[model samples]
Target: MSDLYEKLKRFQQNTPVQKPSPPALVPSSSTSKPLPDQLLKIPGIVRGSQVMEKIQQRDDAKKKFLSTLGVNEVTNPAGKYGYREIKISNRELPITKEDIGGLEIQTISRDASLAVFNANDFLFFDTETTGLAGGTGTTPFLIGIGFFDEDGFRVCQYMMRDYDEEAAVLHDLVKQIGRFPALASYNGKCFDAPILQARFLLNRLRFPITDMPHLDLLFAARRFWKKMLPSCSLSTVESRILGRTREEDISGELIPYVYFDFLRGIRIERMRPVLFHNVEDVVSLAMLAAKICRMVRHPENECRHGWEWFGLGCCLAAAGMWERTFFCLEQAVLEPSLSLEEWIAINKFLSLSYKRLARMKEAVDVWQRMIERGEDVFAMIELAKFHEHTEKKYAEALALTERAILQMRNRQNDVMANGPATVMYEELLHRWNRLLEKRKNP
Candidate 1:
């Protein structure tokens, strides 16, 4: 209800803000903003021939690793066990409900589902692909999977020696999941799953990815951390919620180039650092997932805002957890959107959720007010249909249809060319006229 900008200004004025460090600058006479200092700090950022030398150094490391893990002159136990002394023994960690399940914090212990979250079968995972464009052509150079076993949480990585060894890496991941139940990740839904799936199919590996119940911490980060921080990205979530920070290190963007260096026989030296970066990504996934779970179970401890609840609802909806979705939706609707478009989008989702639960009256009320606040064509059509069918108000329905046409005409008058909206407007006008005639006769 309060002005958002005013509220932000008040909060800033009240809170003792941290004083920023003095920024590094170039010697420029004019009073223009200096170029970023961080840009100058990039290591191994050399492209072309210098970058190729880095790859040769990495390849040399790979060969040394192979020599050290010496071939057995025997077939590996049904799968390629390139360099690791990985054994197929029954070596699960002691993950009882009492030890790992309950957090010391009372709020968190009470909220986590007693039946589902047993702590034994949940694993946190992350990956670094050759490139972000995941196809059969793209390969996962490294995958980091972590869990709390007997010796606290351990990050286990499966790394491909080169592009040629991608199959072995994917096979190990699919095999590892057979030993676990649920998996957790941050934005793994968008990037990790598809990459793994493509790799698996190419290798003739059968992985039951769809069957696995995944908790994408990206969704949870949005829910539990959005109020605490504006960005729900993993690193931000880790910093803001968990009170942790990663030291300046190699980024994921450099990884493909790191591999390309290895491939080109140049970066024989930097593979160690590249592997170090991959290992850190896996470790961060574990830490970030744990941080999110802690916040979700104890919303009070975190001072979460309304957008957190909105995010929570979205997470629950994606997971198909209806009861939890209802709880989150109730919270989100309390804090209506700050802008008309934001309100309409939120209200639209809320109305659809209500509709899913057979709460037609609630859905109708939501759509009606939603249309009044922002009379887009979609809202008008939905409201008009509801008025005609549900309320037996043909006059009201016809009026809404006319309003929709006026909105369309205004939008077209503002159009630059024959875009998608123009075609939709032409179609919508004909549809509205047909609907109005039907209502008039009936």
Candidate 2:
């Protein structure tokens, strides 16, 4: 053991120790900071100066665009971002109070009181949004409100130059919308109002339009023009109902792209058409509201076609005004332009309206007219019921029931072509048996 230990110690002492290799030699130039241009070449590295230059460019573009439109900057004391506003005088618009006067608000808004509010008491509003894909991400970049004052009609538009300015826009809209008692829009109840509410919630602000009486003209317009017009869009109503066609209006789908280009400091001039489109939309909204109000107030004088009378009758029927429904429907059936389908529909409603008002004679006359026009099973059934129960004419009731059964069988054959044909046949057979027993007993 001692000899083995001596040998190991001699081995350790004779071994030579090697020194550590020197560190890699970096060039002196590599130690210095890189130049701005050279650093920019590296991926994922943006120069601070370039960022500031782009921001300055965007600011300059915003200023130039706003200045050209005579927009005034609005400073909010409670918010960091500010918005821009521009007012259009009454002379610039093509509407007057006389055009929109005499509206019965209850006709359009069933909850509203009749004759309490007029055209001046309502505020007409519209919005231009970033996209139709409604969500938190979709923003309303522009808002337009039109109202009547002692002088005349005036339109106020609020615009945000950047996304940060949205809070300020909502802040000011709350104030502006508070002055009006009621609201009117083309489709505000579904689209604009909800979007505004969402924006208000996101901005931590109170929505002023909430709980305000809102009259969405889309419903009324559909009631009046659904059959007459190809579409009930605001643009179609403007051209067809209001007789105003836009010559240079920008397409709505292109508006968001234009706004994005403006934000990126590219072709700021394209925004001009978007602004024009918005202004025209607000103005057209006012005009269309006027037309709709006038039509509801004096449908006899305001309505130009039979379909309008039919629509008015339907509206009145929904409102539970049976007497007015009867009158409008009576007039609707007189026009020769009505198609066979429209004629049959109008007569059906007319008969029901008469029944609601207890004008049985008129109702019977309408049913008779429907029978004369076509083989109407509904009219035959109604007449059979009336004859059997009210007039005590069992023979006539049996005859009408037989006619209705035949009509139903023919319709089923025409439609389904060969089957047991149970469409209304059992009902008719039961009525026939009951009528036969009543006839024999009488």
Candidate 3:
């Protein structure tokens, strides 16, 4: 009877609950691609000297930081695991810091919002790591830096060759990177930067660089290509944006194992695909950044009226382009297929912008509509605050705050509830105390 009961409990535990489908990265809508100018053009990214100056500064910092660690070169010549050295380099490889500084980022967009670069300068970089792990233990044995200047976008990879060359590869990359102002990568913000930071920390080397801005194409791609695809991963974006695909590259999960095989002097063939994969990553970033820049610089020529406008608006706001955000939100609002999520976001942003523009009535109207969408937590919180401060409706604010609190409590998602609910809870106690004080005064 115990055995039977145990088997019955196990069966009950195997039941499936209805999973909440995650929010779509970008809602599907009108099938319009961005304008032709928004297509990636790599040559325009590497055009100027500010870019070069920033690069030099960073390179020196990294070199100074890393030299202290004493791991300066890849000391082995015999390929590991019996693997032979693969001659992946061609045309002497752009070896020096100066040579790489001159490549240009071709501006793909003529949109006004993306006019930061002089229609000419840009940087592109990618990395090949020891493994797929996110921890510091997983080092980038090879770091590739590519950029465009006068000549064009060039792909220069730091080939590990074996344990013997990893140090040399990193050192060379540090020097080369010191020549560009802006840097870019597919998923560099999350993966590349952390990996590089870890490698530098491990070696106790001063990473020679500061004041350089990174445009992670992964996040950018998500905003630009969200309408057409479910995801904005490099593989997906590269296919749609660049008209290129990597069917042949090794899966990222298989990469660390492949490096291990390389260390063991076996599976030299696997390295070829990895190299190709990084090449695609570097090239595609150049293309994608160029495209986004175009849309930013030439918003009037915008072909798609969805996430791109919203994205550019955010970018403009970052650059202190309030008018641009205003314009961007204006364009975003015009899109007929704007989802409930996007509509709320636009309204919130527009409300903020209107306040900045001293248009309180417009901002109030925006929040009122949001209040109507009481199911939307953000909207509810926003409207409650609006009522408290702008309308002087303290009671209305309290009611809205109570509703928000109840909604969060019902879901047991208290930890992430909107700020107003928490504020209201605390403030309620304060107000009660004040009432007691008033009665004593009377």
Candidate 4:
């Protein structure tokens, strides 16, 4: 009897459940491709002729779920998932309408389209997925969106109530996001958007999220805070940079298990935190975007920290805004807390910017500062070249070059070991000889 029961249990687990015929408008398992193996592994996953019945049951459950959270399901302009929007009057987020208004239009590497980006046209996008490492097997269960409105900021959340509702969720996302000129997310360029594209292809639906300017804030966050923060994760940026700490939040790693539990008949309350987490991510994207845009547009007033100034300077420098870049670098070098490496980097850009502005005195000052701080051979070489070529002070250049050569020898093979340094040392010798010849002839 025990062996017979074991055989029956194995058979039941392995057997494919019969799917109920769905409504014409609704996607059925037969027409849609099979769910991935990961999704199929959830216990009590809807199957059999009862599939339609379960869907009906899910509708009631979804109603209760949304009611418990005080959010309503929007089905109008149908094919929407559990979509709803909320307006916040006094949200503690950092972005304002004016900040979004001033955001500069930048080119996207992927799309090669350049247009002035309006914050109104940008949909702040984020996704909560069943798996982070994306493949065809993974699913995007929740999509969170935020945007600026006349009143303030509006955030919309679309969630998949069950595995079969993924198509509805995706379709609704496309309908909403496709109309927007661009999508902004923390790391959507590499992760969220691509995974979503994969899910779209797997579902045999048209991938509508494309060709728009994508502002992936992860790159921006790294540029701004990678030096100070231990990690560049959104949560880290939220706490460390944005000054927002999440409480009562569900850990992202456990989110998949929460969805799996819901499939296995767990109470809807368990998934509330997951929904809240997604909402927070979307809101944070908006806040971070506003902060970055402000720093870029008005670094002198907005950027407070030395590292922040340095980061903004690098961005301005890249954009060829030499005057603003110089000002930011000037502020950055005044920051007494800068690390040696940070100090060096800021001074290098500062000097370069000064040179670009034809301010040789300021450029020489930066190089001199670098040398006073430490025995930077690169700074010494730059200053020597400046003296020899710009100021025509050959004797001063010869003295600096001789000091570099003496230090290079005292360091015992330091210059000889580096190919570039060796070449620099030989060049210094040539400069010293040239200066001596000039002195002899004069």
Per-residue lDDT over 295-379 for candidate 2, one digit per residue giving the tens place of the 0 to 100 score: 7778888888788898888877777877777778888889888888889988998888788778899999999989998878889
Please give each candidate's TM-score.
0.54, 0.84, 0.57, 0.79
Which model is ahead, 1 or 2, in terms of lDDT?
2
**Candidate 4's error at 436, in angstroms?**
4.5
Segments of candidate 1 deviating more than 4 angstroms: 1-117, 127-143, 158-244, 259-273, 288-308, 315-327, 330-339, 355-361, 375-381, 393-395, 414-442
Error of 3 at 108 (Å): 15
Model 1 lDDT at residue 219: 57
**If candidate 1 were superposed on the true structure by all CA atoms, what would the RMSD be?**
26.4
CA lDDT of every candidate: 0.63, 0.80, 0.61, 0.77
Native-to-model Cα distance after best TM-score fit, residue 137 in candidate 1, in Å: 6.7
lDDT of 4 by residue, 1-442 (tens): 9999999999999999999997677545456545675566675553643687876787687668777775666564334457667676645545676665423434111223424666777898888888878787888888888887777778888877777677777767777877687788888988888888988898788887767677888887777788878999999889987799888698888898888877755676788898889888988888887777777766667777898888777776677777777887888889988889878988887887787788889988888988888766777888888887877887888788888878777875777688987887788788789878866774
Checking candidate 4 for backbone clashes, the offending pairs are none
Q: 1 or 2, which is superior by TM-score?
A: 2
TM-score of 3: 0.57
Ranked candidates, highest lDDT first: 2, 4, 1, 3
Q: How should the candidates be ordered by TM-score, best one leading?
A: 2, 4, 3, 1
